[model samples]
Target: MNAPYIHGRRRTFSASAAVDTQNAVITSIKTDDGATWSDMGRVLGKSEDRAAAYANTASPIDLPTFLAGCHEWGGRFADPLLALVGGRWADAGAICTGDEAAALTIANLLPAIIAIEADNLTEPHELLPHEVLIRRVHALTAIWLEMIATEKGRAR
Candidate 1:
């Protein structure tokens, strides 16, 4: 689901989803100017099999909450690619195989993330957008990838 958000602007967007438990039906809602949300009603019932397929395919990916939040915020900030890389790094760190280099790389990223958060608090929103955070995240991801590669090399 994707929507545009402009501060102090009147815009309308719709969100819809269909589910098949006992029946196939769609539920939808729309918000005008970020206010006065109203139901858009369900339409286009599909075959139960089709709905089931959709449900099966739509299962959420398992990820840590903090990493997921970072990805969501990255999308809102219009830098999903970078946020995704950061999320991958977080995932690698979580499942790290007790390698010293991987541990050190993950530790190094903590201060960078903290510094980015600190800078965000002081700068205007426009001045310190997600791009800046993404750059740091990308750097962290590179370090993480290098550490993983090094660990793999040592294994062989």
Candidate 2:
């Protein structure tokens, strides 16, 4: 049985399930996104028909194959798999303006961080609801990542 997280129930990582999910990602790139397996093949350095077989199978795919497939269609389908590994994918083209992102993030993340216990729990008064916490984290992460990316862009 998978251990329960006080946060939530996350599934145990199954290699077989992950392979199936990878194959599904490949197939969706073809069926939903109108990406030819040949196009995926080019992306992954394979032949016109090479990726087609992987699209229809339960076999394990290379990391490049999984990444190329996800890149074609965006992360709506891939987020669960990424989350399973404690990872997230973001679009390189996402845009934000001014101090707008930081302001929005701060406004959303209510229940101020006044008391962090020695244990890991926040004081009851300082805790946001679970849904609010999730939203705030995503907001803060995007804002911070965009800040870093902007700085890197300027340095180039």
Candidate 3:
């Protein structure tokens, strides 16, 4: 299989047609609302050309530093990054503490995993495989980590 990042780029291209460049960590979004480049440029503290260039091909060395800016793009970068790590946005989703998240993740995952093993799918992907119950544990792990971090006041 290809590297995780290669798959990430593939999914990014598949999910958001605007990320038309390889190795691109971000994309210039142009929805019906407006052109996002200018605002994105401003947010990243760079000119439009500079922002576009960074979005097009953020080198691996610069990616870590640049990602701090990308996070400000809201879900534009978040969603793709989550998907890269086998996840999706859950901000407007469930609200639960680490304990609750554990119970919820287990309560939700057990049956589906059993069903999958038994070759019985109760429902569709609900949309994407990433949205399936099989991924609940992974997402929940991340959630719980953050929840713990927050509880300990170590969140960044």
Candidate 4:
């Protein structure tokens, strides 16, 4: 296993992808103040797609869990401006609280990003829904800004 890196909220996150048939992709997160590591569970199997190809796989991450977490965090009320850009109201703050939230947001964006890539590869003229794209971008931006703020706070 590789060394874990600090993700946020003083948590260390790490993952090990399968290299052989006997291995499985594993992910775990540990809090700086805690002695025990919390397992985030397996991300992939050796028999499954290669770890390097994860980005190209459809539904590479857990979408339902991520979406549910976002909803649970009250993302719908986090940002009023989202209504203007995407014709929908959502609270971006709901998922910008910490490193885990940031990870979730990134995971949430992956499938769409992959789809965009697939579209580019297959049908360059395919038009994605502008509002959907706007909402995702807005959410990602909000999370990014929050992370920066958190990091700045740490600096002081």
Candidate 5:
């Protein structure tokens, strides 16, 4: 006689890799279509080196601050500028132009995604879990919505 055996899959998370992917995505978006670091750098009111350094970090602490500053400077366009830097979908184009509730829903979910990446993933170098990566994509979309909302709010 043999007893049945079952094993559950172990889930892993990688905050570092998730953050890195996020940075790479953002960098790609910001540099797209002849956009220069100096143009974006103006948002931070800092020299190119300083702006690049802040953008390259894995931490999100500076992102919110930077975006707020950009809003103060560039007005409605700032939303799209920040969205581009956050790596929203290419189709997302500029900032979101409609749907306030939905946008906020997406924005609020980013922390959970970050938490998942911070918790349930590990590879040879500790990459984010597949689920977390998916969440990051979703978070990027949400950020786009937030940007749109920012622009719309300013318009009204």
Candidate 6:
């Protein structure tokens, strides 16, 4: 369960709030003078009314909350990648030979994943217009999920 935050008293992370903020940021990006909610909704796969509400009722997405979501999302996907690496290690030990080649292949890929994960989590929505940033994030997340599924398949 997410923790309740009382700023002056106790502070806790709220994933829901983060998502809400993300919704708002997306709205803000879509509703700029140059963009319309309909266009934004089309890009984000949301309905026009939902997009407008997000824009109209949007609140600032706190940096910490946004960063936390990024970390959580990345971690959810990274688990399988690490497991695949572990399985490769196990295979090496079982076969009385090191699959250092396979291991090395996975190792080489880790840096790119780490870098991408960092960017996905830490990059501000403000860096790009609303539609571009949101779409990029969605694409990155899809890639991350694919990696996890592939890794898990390899592990089995």
Each model's C-alpha lDDT? Answer: 0.37, 0.64, 0.53, 0.39, 0.52, 0.47
Runs off by more than 4 Å, candidate 3: 1-25, 28-33, 58-71, 74-100, 117-131, 138-156
Clashing pairs in 2: none
Q: Residue-wise lDDT of candidate 6 within 16-129, one digit each (tens)?
A: 554454564554444443678676555445566765654465443344433432343333322322233332113223564432444454555555556656746745443343
lDDT of 3 by residue, 1-156 (tens): 734335433333343333333235445343432657676567666677766665665432145434555456555555655555455455555773443456776787676556555754455553245355546577677767866866676444
* Cα shift from native, residue 111, model 6 (Å): 30
User: Candidate 2 at residue 121, lDDT?
Assistant: 80
Most TM-score-accurate candidate: 2
**Can you list the residue pairs that collide in candidate 6?**
none
Q: How many backbone clashes does candidate 4 have?
A: 4
Each prediction's TM-score versus the true structure: 0.20, 0.45, 0.42, 0.24, 0.30, 0.26
- Clashing residue pairs found in predicted model 3: none
Better of 2 and 3 by lDDT: 2
The TM-score of predicted model 5 comes to 0.30
The window of 10 residues in a row where model 5 has the poorest summed lDDT is 1-10
lDDT of 4 by residue, 1-156 (tens): 322244433422223221121121111111222212122222222223432333333324344433432353333321221222333334645543333454565676667567767735734344355445546557678757887977886799
Which window of ten consecutive residues has the lowest lDDT sum in model 4? 21-30
lDDT of 5 at 135: 60
Give the CA lDDT, 0 to 100, for residue 27 in model 3.
52
TM-score of the candidate numbered 2? 0.45
How many clashing pairs does model 2 include?
0
